[model samples]
Target: MSHDLFLAAKAAMKNAHAPYSKFPVGAAIRTTDGRIFSGCNVEIASYPEGWCAETTALGHYVTGGGGEIAEIAVIAERMAKVTPCGGCRQRLAEFAPAEAKVYLCDDAGVVGTVTMGELLPYGFKGGILKK
Candidate 1:
């Protein structure tokens, strides 16, 4: 079921623009409706100001008429199971439900899996902001 998402992530990783770090990363999001959106890390001379692969994927998801996110896949050229960063975790939680699957992938395929809640146990809740 997740093999396609892994493939999308792997393909996106190949297009990453990380010359400065030389570490390309890719991310893919799967909507509940089976739509897949993939993105690669884009870096510039401005250092850490560039967006992450997950962030880029989220941008696409939102622009494509945001839907319930069911699963996610992340991959990097250097790390076998590179999890989303702190900010990316929160960003994912904003759209994906707590039980949403997050797949960690290596060069070959998915190496591990975690839930959105597991990724950010104490993350800020959007509901709290509305209160």
Candidate 2:
């Protein structure tokens, strides 16, 4: 099942439009109910205006009707281990629980898996917004 998520990410990487950076990235997330959402990095000339793969996938998750994320998979071309950036880590926390499994893929299958809590141990979340 985890490998299925990685395959989805790898397939999404083919759609990345990163001309300037040439560093295409793909991400896939499994919703709590078993649906898989995938996205690839979309780059723009402005650099900062581009969106990461995870955010793209998360956008789909939101528009497709929000739900908890059960697992996440990420893949890059050359990186041996491609983990989500700080922004993605926090974004994932919005849907995934602290113990949600994350898969970082390389060329083979799932290279490693870590919990969301391990990814962002001290993250500041909207829990603070209640006040």
Candidate 3:
């Protein structure tokens, strides 16, 4: 089932709109309810206005009424491994637990799997700010 998520991410990468960077990325997230959401990076002409694939997938999951991501997969080309960026890591933390599995993949397949906490230790939690 995890491998299936990676495959879905790879499929999504085909539709990435990265004309400028030429570095396409795809992301897939599996909710605790067993539903999977996939997304591709969409780059814009304006700088710093682009969205990461992980953010896109999270949006789809939230829009679909999903809660608590169990696992996530990120795939990209020409890299040893692909992981979510810092901003995306925080975005993912909003809907995923610290122990959620994060799969890093390349064109071949999954290269590694790390927990969300490993990706972003001491991540900013909304409750912390509320105090």
Each candidate: how many clashes?
A: 0, 0, 0
Using TM-score as the measure, what is the rank order of every candidate, best first?
Answer: 1, 2, 3
Tens digits of lDDT, candidate 1, 31-53:
99999999999998998779899
lDDT of 3 by residue, 29-99 (tens): 99888899999999999946899999889889989998878999999865658889999999999889999
- On lDDT, the stronger of 1 and 2 is 1
Residue pairs clashing in model 1 are none
Cα deviation in Å at residue 96, candidate 3?
0.4
Using Cα atoms with residue i matched to residue i, what is each candidate's TM-score against the true structure?
Answer: 0.98, 0.96, 0.95
User: Which scores greater on lDDT, model 1 or model 3?
Assistant: 1
Give each model's whole-structure lDDT: 0.95, 0.90, 0.90
Which sections of candidate 3 miss by over 4 Å?
none
Candidate with the greatest lDDT versus the true structure: 1
Sequence-dependent TM-score of model 1: 0.98
